[model samples]
Target: MSEKIKIVLAEDEPSLALIIKESLETRNFEVIVTEDGDQAYNAYISEKPELLVLDVMMPKKDGFTVAEQIRKQDKRIPIIFLTAKSQTQDVVDGFKHGGNDYLKKPFSMEELIVRIHALLNRVENNQGSDDGLTHIGGYIFDYAKQSLTYDGNTEVLTYREAEVLKHLYSTKNEMVTRSHILKEIWGDDDFFNGRSLDVFITKLRKKLDKDKNVQIINSRGYGYKLIC
Candidate 1:
């Protein structure tokens, strides 16, 4: 039999933590549950789990802080934020701190499992395309390095940012709805996620602004069209 995929879960609520752990275990995942941020970081460092599911609120250290600390060392380990703070800025902050996906509180076990599966599949599929490269406007994007280079300059992008840009580039000149992007990237199309998608779009606009030929146009209440 293949080895079970390991997961490090940091959640302060005992009942919720227990439920998530039980659910993951039933799905054949090896879960290490921690109630505080400190223990969660320790578990991550020692156990080296394949994925991390973290709550934004925790004792000793918050999920954002832990994620920042982890990102300093490991950039590719998938991090998912589980929090009740669904505000636009909060979601932006979560992504800035290294979250690959966000799940608001009151989420269902099935939703969480589906997200886990989607993320794991994405990570696995990305491995085979490490050397793939794409051209967007005047910039050269290297998938393996997660970087964009233009005119002798290169900027390394965060994992989520790279994914968003790649998707936009793939469908350049076509309209992509906010809900479609949220579902494709974050696995949900909630209000907070809609706001978060806006944040990412703003960042991508800034990054691709140097190329006059590349434009990300907001369709106002509909979606965005990336023209290159």
Candidate 2:
């Protein structure tokens, strides 16, 4: 029998937290719910869950802070930020602080389940090479570590960033359509996800800039090409 997937859910509201925990438990997931950011962080350290669902607003450290701390220890864990705020900057900040996905609050259980499955499947299927390292131009992309090293300087990447880079590297020199990447990584090719993809591409360019020969070029109406 397969082991049950474990998840750490950090939400402050007692009613909402209980509902989420019960819903996930019904689906056979091992859910560990924490009421605040500090407890959430501690739960994460002890539980070592497969995924994390963090509410953006909480007592003590907030979801972003918890995510930041966790990223320092484990770069590849999938983190989904839950927020009531729909501000563009808030969304951007979530991604900036190591979030792989975002789910606005007042969400449906089905939607949450789908996001959880998409993240887990992506991580499971993309655990590249035994050593978890790939070479591109003069840089080394460490898949497991979620980092890129150039000239001995390593730039640690967020989980989503590593996944995006890995996808580009797999089909280097070929035109990979934006829709394909969005569907493959984000599980959707909608406008919001498209914008998020653009953000990740921009971040990748800066990290890979140390090597002059590497570039991620856009194809106007089509998609992007990784020119290495």
Candidate 3:
């Protein structure tokens, strides 16, 4: 059976939200609608939707805060920001905050639908799993366990770490851009996440350094290359 596209839509404009909800439902998407950022965050945590459509201007919290919190817990969910602020800085700031795609107010429902499908498609491509396991250097990755065992001792990895390692292992010796890492491991790209990624890189380096044969090569502002 085909999986239903799960969506969390947070729009304070009730009429706009309803229009988007109906349009998505007509396309067979499973949607959870909310009117505030707090409710959006609740929907994200409780329902764990596949995709999120957030509005910047909302009561309780803003889309940026909601996205930031979500990034800390779940990194593999796509996010789209819908807002009326068309300023250059606002658009740049949205991407810097964790938006996969940005849409201004009064957007065509059809365009929004297209963007949704495209984001979901990209997510599907990145989530493609092969073999369910990968071995690098002296480490044998148990993707299912989200743990790395070296020298008979196992170290538990955070969700993002595991996903990042797995993808890196799969694409060993290739240049995996930071954007690719964010999209595949955290589902969005932003400033908060950009810093978190550095921390993850440090942790990963420490974890795999025990085995000299395994190296996570950093390409500066680029990404990582897992060498075995």
lDDT, each prediction = 0.87, 0.88, 0.79
- Tens-place lDDT per residue, model 3, 1-228, is 147788999999888889999989999898899999999999998987889999998999999889878866755577889989866667656655666667788799988888788778766775655336566777878765567888788897654577678778778899899988876554556765566677777878998889888888888988889888
Q: Which candidate is the best by TM-score?
A: 2
Backbone collisions counted per model = 0, 0, 1
Per-residue lDDT over 1-228 for candidate 1, one digit per residue giving the tens place of the 0 to 100 score: 138989999998999999999999999999999999999999999998999999999999999999989987877788999989867888889998889988888999998888888998878876766577888879988866678899979998876788788888778899998778888888878887778778778888898899999899988988888898
TM-score of 3: 0.59
Off by more than 4 A, model 2 = 128-130
Q: Please give me the total number of clashing residue pairs in predicted model 3.
A: 1
Instruction: Estimate the lDDT of model 1.
Output: 0.87
- Candidates ranked by lDDT, best first? 2, 1, 3
Best by lDDT: 2
CA lDDT, candidate 1, residue 57: 93
Clashing pairs in 3: 75-186
Off by over 4 Å in 3: 128-228
TM-score of 1: 0.88
Clashing pairs in 1: none
Model 1: residue 138 alpha-carbon error in angstroms: 2.3
- Per residue, candidate 2 scores C-alpha lDDT tens digits across 76-194 of 78899899988766777888898988888889999999999988987776565524678899999987887888888898887778888988998899999999998887777877778
